[model samples]
Target: MRIRPTSARGGLPPAAASAESPAALSGPDGRRLPASPRRRRPDLAALAVLLILGGTAATITLMLNGSARVSAIRITRQVTAGQPLSRAGMEEVRIAGTGIDYLPWSQHASYAQRLALVTLLPGTLLTTQMTATASEGITPGKARVGLALKPGQSPAELRAGQRVQIISLPRQDPGDRTTTVLAQSALVDAVSDPGTHGPPRLVNVIVDAALSPRIAAYASNGQIVLAYLPAAH
Candidate 1:
């Protein structure tokens, strides 16, 4: 008798069995329909591409933000009206460009002789219009005058950067007791700290240049008073 090799488990191979009855989708008409395509699996190559794109977008955004900033000048200390700017009182800071007429750090030296048009607090961003370059006064139309006011001349709670009205009290020379308004809208630049039996309170105010000469003369008589004018600035 001749020996012959049979298939494993005495059954048809996988290929021949599958070919006998192929897998297919059945339609409503009892006909075969096409099988759907196999779904694809995610791979590291696609993930790597996504990560690269994200990093590029972040880098571009950082560059655009950095390029939009510019260097400007900042005051390091309090500078009163009519006070000149100094090299040690200024520093450079970076800010987003706003297209305003702000003072640039490179031109800080040019503002040394110029006076502050208004009382500048610390950490202030300097601007071109805040300085008077033409004269020793605070501004083209304003002059800063220091008045030694008596205790009752100004409010005890008066502070700097406040608006006030300058009035002159009548004297005994004539029978006139009328009060005079020297300045309607004056800016208080600086206020001296009070103390016990100390010197008179020295208040610095910026008023019109035309009234400066007369105000300084009248203030020496100790008859001038500072009337608080809120919301006048």
Candidate 2:
């Protein structure tokens, strides 16, 4: 029999014996095996746990904060002041909670019977001020009167929801500066532009029912002039 070179460590060659002396390295198959078992790094394991915990905490926080969402009314179109809330012009939407006493969608029927205190633009969120049911409109004790106005009679910048004071201009004597205040504070429902020709333009204003006749009389003779109210901001 031929004798193979050996080391003091037995079976293993001098090179293998000097590199590793474990029992796993005692056979020829041991040279093909790893010196130690593979294990996951503790740092990577901790990072994975932190990621999972962070995601779970974020989910829980969102669940808690999302509960403040509420169903409220949102205006879908322009609604003039003193006009009833049209069902087609409004809709219900989910939104975050608000501190204002905003009108809820559940009270649609109640506010539908009421009138707006101010002109509401498109996409406006409904509020209590827009849903006042008292006699703050051109109904009950109010009147909607259309006035024919020439240039200089009303401000060109006048628009709906503007509060104005209607005055009857003095007679054309140059010496007569006495102007009669027909309506103290009337709400302008709508006003059309007079354009450049200085032609008569129509203006619809809401006034007390008692003042409608006088206002119409002055308007007929083109003596009606509108003064912007300082009370409106």
Candidate 3:
């Protein structure tokens, strides 16, 4: 039998022995494989936790940002529908909470002060533009009537659109002690200036169709005096 070098075993050379050592086996191209595939480090767990917590905090903050409240606005004057509103005439107002306040004013509200101005009350008229919507409740009408005064009669002698009690004496014949007082209401249609014949001051009055005849008869006599009625309650 031929004798090989003493260091050789099973036909492997000395160089192969050094390559089989643990350090060399752990190196690249080693048949024993490198560092057990380098276990994925567990240190990344804390970073994942931080990211999750941050996302949760952001979500909570976004949920708490909205609210509501009641508001008030002022009526500048006796506003009739179809009339324009002037800034000089109107003012801002505020209202107390009834129960909830939807769309509460921001920190930058224009009328933060002047809390004395409360909600609008009845008889407080608002301009058409001040109204929430364009639609209106008042209706317009025609059939214009005017008041005419005789010479030397003062305009004050005519009361526009008033209710009065009239006492007519029967033809002076004095029959049946016939003293009849007619009581009715009439609107002041119009009145003429004492000196002018061209046209009279116009007044608008609303009355029932039946009452129109009686009013026309009495008014034509030229002896009638007009009176104004107090506004209805």
Candidate 4:
């Protein structure tokens, strides 16, 4: 028998043994192994932009819903105490940031024919504290009376919502010309111009009901004069 040259372990050639090694067995059909899939990194800049845009959109939506304006009631003309509130004397104005204390325009019907508690100027915002019903103007044991006074009888600065003292001047008799205070701290409800050449102006005031008879008597004789009280009092 003829002896053939072989490798020590498997009786194969060295080149053939190397080709069948474990490294070559890892690939299919003895081809090179494909490179592992590359790991992907997150784009931080793009993610930051997306987050900022989302926050901006949320803020804009909140502003549009919360900052919307509505109509409120405001006086267009002067409103005196004890006078009825009419729609003609007021207007609806669109305003922003209105609070709960403000009166809305839709509630004007309830305030119509209501008496104003104080003197309301033009452009004044109507409020619940500014108005009342006609019966609300009269207090317990008090009555409302009207006085017709000449130009010189009342002070030029006397106006609605003012406090005054009704003084009874002495007649042209032999007694002292000292004046007597008939009523003190009387609330002036309203004042009106005669709108003509020579008539006296009318002033309505609230006083004790017991004094109504005496005040009417003095007013009939034109012996009553008005004295303005200090605002602080």
Q: Top model by TM-score, which number?
A: 4
| TM-scores of all predicted structures | 0.46, 0.49, 0.32, 0.53
Please report, in order, the local distance difference test score of every candidate based on alpha carbons.
0.79, 0.78, 0.40, 0.79
Q: On TM-score, who's better, 1 or 2?
A: 2
lDDT of 1 by residue, 100-153 (tens): 877988998988656677888879999977886533345577788999987888
Stretches of candidate 4 above 4 Å error? 1-5, 11-13, 20-65, 68-101, 104-127, 130-136, 195-197, 230-233
Query: Model 3: residues >4 Å from true position, as ranges?
Result: 1-146, 151-183, 195-204
What lDDT would candidate 1 get against the real structure? 0.79
Query: Can you give the lDDT of residue 221 in candidate 4?
Result: 86
Q: Once model 1 is optimally superposed onto the true structure by TM-score, how far is the C-alpha of residue 73 displaced, in angstroms?
A: 15
lDDT of 4: 0.79
Report the lDDT tens digits of candidate 2 across residue range 157-190. 8766566899999887899989999998887776
Q: Clashing residue pairs, candidate 4?
A: none
What digit string (tens of lDDT, one per residue) describes model 3 on residues 75-185? 444433222233343444454445533223332133221111123333343222233211121225422323343443223454332333333334434474564433344
TM-score of 3: 0.32
